[model samples]
Target: MQSIPYSVTLRPKIFVFTVMGTYAALAPIAVSSVFQHLLAVPMSVLLTMVSVCIFAVAWIMQREETSFKALNRIGISMILAIALPAFLSIAASIYALTVVQSVEYVAYFQHSLLNRLINIGMFATLSLLILFFIQKDVRKVTYSLTQGYFVGLSVLVAGGVWQFLHFTIGYPMPGFETRAFVHSVSEDVLINFRLTSFTDEPSFLVPFLIDGLIIGGMLLSKKAYSLYAIPAVLVLLLSFSVSGYVNLAVIVFSATILLFARGIIPKKVGLYAIISILILGMITVLIFPQLITALFMPIIGRLDSLFDVMHHSRLYMLVFPFVWLFDYSSINALFGFGPGSYDFLARTKYLSHQGAVSGTSNNAFIDLLFEHGVFGGLVFICVFIGVFVYLWRKRKGHLYNSIALLLWIHLGLTNMYRSDFASPRFWIIVLIVIGLTELAKRNITLSDRRASSSYKKKVTT
Candidate 1:
């Protein structure tokens, strides 16, 4: 057999190098700033660039193959999934500038446009990742996110230690501004030794910690896990913010789905998962008696307050978002006003500049509708439906991967930014789901089935 010429061999290498280098540059850019998860910002850019590069590779390698034909529908779905949102935002931006003619409204469109672009960018990048590496080493992306956490943690620990030393020394470092905490007595609570670390406040830290929890969840192997996710579970339970608790729920639920779907989770581990969840629930009850009360009490009491206390008056102020959504022009209705425009107008008009509704739609569903309009919203719904139907069709298998996607779906339904999935926790969990889902997309390959059988054998052993 003759070896391919140096020139021909060099061509493949050149193509691969270009794809990878471009991928590296775009990964971080594609990342959206999902809340305060700083990692999201860079990861998006990296993921996007990488995705495009790999997609090119897929096109090249599969040029003479049947794999492309088999999966082309999914590819098209992915493209349309992205395009729908971008189109909606663009349409909205046009409406805001041309029809509304209001500077404040234009600002909103600007934000809306940028956000849609970022969200589209995310989907584009991920589709590419799957096309490239997943086609080669399916585990490559999974290991990156799981292992990436370890990398991020190492940084967190180092910073923590440095801060610990700074406080110990009373080091009056002037140039370097470090997170500081002070003990303050409040009227409601006793002297609280508050700790402000990094860009995160004590309150925000709850969500941050909860987000890091995928690390523990990924520890689920064939042997057993010692309810290790329990500690993180408890911390999330005791979190003051409802959002923080929700984040925790997302992590656990996703972890559970992934482990169970793969059939690698041991009986001991399953027992631990159930017990751990219940135990964490009990611990939460012990620590914060009024916690649940605080979250729901306001929502519940409103019904009585409207009828009895306020004498059946409308909750007009609270319902400003709903009213605004309807009050906008037909053009604005078809295409959202813009991003910062909504809340910015609210501040200028002095409506609401606080809470989730402060910037975007307070109601996520409505906000999605408002930004993308009906058509764009429909596109989103279709993508979700496709994702859901695709999973449901294969529900009997790939249970773990389905569960992971379910958790993402759960978060998406709740008050979450669509782009939040750009965060490290979100992306890692997503890639994990992707890895597992790919296993289910087929009629159990002999190797995968054998892996599952082997996993089961180890469990019984």
Candidate 2:
């Protein structure tokens, strides 16, 4: 085969590198008091700015190559899934505004609609820009993203360790500013340290650590990558996030059903997985006995907290949206009060009744259902179900397919608490997996062509 032109490859390679590097550097810094104060802007806005720059680079590099033909059925489906909700939401928001009794409620609805538009706009723009680069060279982009993902997670591990030491041993570190940064403190850092690491809160940090543990152990299959699991597991226990604990249970249960019960992943892989879990468990118990209670708290003491929404503000915040959905008018339930309407309701309706602190539905599923109504919520859910089935069918050799599938499962559960759709943790894995599936299809096509050509030559001979 002839070598591709140097100029043709060089620009795309640079674009991929830059995109991954920016994401790795900036995505995890959302909670940093230093960076937060320095930028004086939300992480979503920073990501959008970097994306715009990356998009410009992609346009220059792939202007001639870019086309609507780059999109496939799967891509079209994702676009429609996202777009349909926005339209439904806007229509619903307009209707809600007409019925709202007070001017105060109208302002709340308008603010919510604007916020939804910004989030959707940012997410859509970033996704399209990344997709454009992926279309240029799927393999290069996928490799860069995977490398960046692990690197970013490794950095988080390091940060978590530092934070643990800083709070415990009085290690001097700048910018940790607990007054501004620490969201809540239970038993104090000396007694039972909650490791926030680099992120704003413990719950925010748990999902990333979980990704490192699961994806790194099950899919990546590198010894070095697997080692990250040790510290990740350690930090996860230290974080003391109930949602994280629930997600861990979900991961274990789902893997058991997928591996042993359904026979989806191979048996050999399942054996190794069991061994890995055992080893991680032993290490956690032996070394960190003080922190070991965290592993069991979710199942033992805190299990009821999951159901007791009124006592636990986070759970209440999550369930409040659903309560609002069913209790209110059928028309309101059909198409929610509009995006961001939950916050208003939490303050006005929920607070008045329950006297709980103001909060939005931290759960994305609840948020979607409450904000967009029944039809819109179902569409969003169906899209995920479709993607899950697609990934399951395309489980080729336990690399990208396996990584994407498990990662999606993790993200799906994590979204119950972590509702920020604009976060890189949500979109980066998605776009990378999409690119990987495309590359996999291309490889299969080439292999088929080669086999066909060889058969024709054999017949001729």
Candidate 3:
């Protein structure tokens, strides 16, 4: 390891790790980059490697700099939070499988224990590293808002462009090919010429993209952010998924409550603002019924079909998993089922023609429950809620809180794209968000401490 004066502060190590963390958060772009050969591995795998490497290198660097260790306890906590459940499952899974039959019966170990162990060891090592580095970031108000908007919009832009080229023009980037095949014209999505560029024949990208833009819009106080809603809402309406409207309703309500609560604007302002928007919206809907119907109403029809499938005992999709969720005999319930396990089950069902197939799980909570079980679900949700509650309470008048609230909103949407973590861009933005939040907290705490100390000195003097 190279050494410089402690005064220099290993900013490079911090920066490099931060980049890697960001890469791990945004998956859409990363997946495309992987197939483009701009990167050597799948973006998903690369994200893990980057996270793992950063932790490893940062650890080495920390050992060489004693003073830095004092500040790195944050990193240690991140690692534990991420890795503990994962590694525990790895050990527990193996033990459980061995009991049912033999070590050979465990699918992950069928090839070689060394390979399985290496994966486990890597996850454990990286998770600990993250725990050491992460802390409460103290972000200034305007800066945090800017960072949130940047991140929120970055994802929207990437996903939108990718979808347009793939679905509308029939030009699929190698990574985006599956989308073309799945959303083919037979799906009934090509009704309007202006809206088809979204690449999702059924308009899945609409809600995803608009949801992000909505977050950005909420953080924006000026007309600049408000103007963004026109295109975003339009695209979302076009997605033809009925739930997109539900998503819009939820996002609007969430955003208004969040923005108003933060003193970004007064609650009375929000009420008047909502009344004005509703009145204007009604006028527009009445005058331009055809246009609105073409874009937004199309998706609403899909709701009945979706519910129809669920009603016919698609309960297996939502229910069968509970057996494993509670089964003490399986390693899944206590520690975790591990990442990608439920997808594996769903994929198997697809292959057998027993389940309706889509790459994404329809529900985020259910998806989480199936994979990580009670403990993992609790930790993940609690962390999310804790972040929100802490932001709402501790940080007054910060845009990052708006962003945090939006991310939670995204998570709250029934089906969060789990693979989101694979994107470098997404991770970078989220990393900054988290880091900024942590930094801001520390600044406030230190400021309070100094003030207290000064008062004591004055009293003594």
Candidate 4:
């Protein structure tokens, strides 16, 4: 068959891939180009600008049909899940002001409301535009997104390795002073003496790395990607992020079991995984003896204190919202206060006794409940379950679908330590997963049609 000549569609496809690819590539790096310190803008803001271009260029070109009806059930479900929180936040903010008549609380509530609205707006806008691009061409978007993200991750992992080497052998790296303006809190990262790479914190770097592992697993068969997994694992260890370790352990363990149960992996695969873990552990201990006390001890202490309210600040933040909820009206329990309201709630109600003026829920699950209320939070949860089930159903004997499922799982697990929804990487992964699902559906439909046509022709013959 002669190859079809390239046409006008080629330009739009190139533009879409470039914009989407650059957006994905920039997710892992947190520092912005223009500013430093107190006035520093995050790279995410720049990414948002990039997203607008995606909408503009696509709108101007009008080469392909775009409509709300183009959205699949999964896409529509996510929009609703996000919309519920924004709606509840507005309603709850109004209700909260009426109940707590303090001028101080009003100021805080307004601030929180505005920020939450922005977060919701940003998430919705990015999701919709990306969904448009995905709907335009699923295969191109899928390949570009996955490849672009892996490239960004590779750069981040390389930076982590460089940081580790500099710390270990005095190999002269750039001073933290240079990164201080870009990094959110350089002092905290400095004090930890762990590898953070280009991210603001060790924990902040974990999610991207976990996603890298997910992508690496997904593309291992398609590309020579397995080699990159080694340095990624090393960098994960070097970060000494407890949340990273915990999330990785859970994901790897659960994935291993699921794959085994499905016969995707033989019994020997389990044994091999065990051996790999032991070997990696032994190698780390031998090379980085400091991890025994620095990494493992802290992990042990944190886990041991997991239930202790005073000792575990994250746990305290997670559980304390309910304290204020119970003190307020029962209706507040159903809808909570509002988005961004947690900061004020934390100050006056949750941690007022300690004289703390600022705090965060830290846990996204708790943030959803405390800010948006139980009803809104449950809406988001239902969306997650729906996406998981859809992906899981399609995951069997499908590599990209399996990767998409794992990534969705990663998002859930990573949120245990993070609550911010406006992050570009989070949405990038979400869009990629959605694209993969849609691509798989399209391929399967075409496959069925082809088979049916063949059957009809055979019968006529």
Best by lDDT: 4
Sort by TM-score, top down from the best: 4, 2, 3, 1
Task: Tell me the spans in candidate 2 whose CA falls farther than 4 Å from its real position.
Answer: 1-9, 31-34, 65-69, 175-191, 214-221, 252-304, 326-329, 350-359, 396-398, 444-461
TM-score of each: 0.61, 0.79, 0.66, 0.82
TM-score of 2: 0.79
Q: Pick the candidate with the highest TM-score.
A: 4
Query: Which portions of model 3 miss their true places by more than 4 Å?
Result: 1-28, 31-40, 47-59, 62-82, 98-105, 108-237, 241-245, 283-291, 309-316, 324-339, 347-364, 395-399, 412-430, 442-461
- What candidate 4 gets wrong by more than 4 Å, as runs, is 1-9, 31-41, 177-192, 220-223, 268-295, 301-304, 349-359, 444-461
Candidate 4 has an lDDT of 0.69
Compose the digit string of candidate 2's lDDT tens values, residues 304-345: 545666666676766666666866467777877676666666
lDDT of 3 by residue, 82-173 (tens): 44554665565566564545332355334433443444455555444443455312333223334434554555554555555555677665
Q: Under the 3 Å rule for N, CA and C atoms, how many clashes does model 4 have?
A: 1
In order, candidate lDDTs are 0.47, 0.66, 0.48, 0.69
Rank candidates, lDDT, best first: 4, 2, 3, 1
Candidate 2 collision pairs:
none
In model 2, the worst 10-residue window by lDDT is: 179-188
Error of 1 at 336 (Å): 2.7
Winner on TM-score between 1 and 4 is: 4
TM-score winner, 2 or 3: 2
lDDT of 1: 0.47
lDDT of 1 at 377: 53
lDDT of 2 at 395: 62
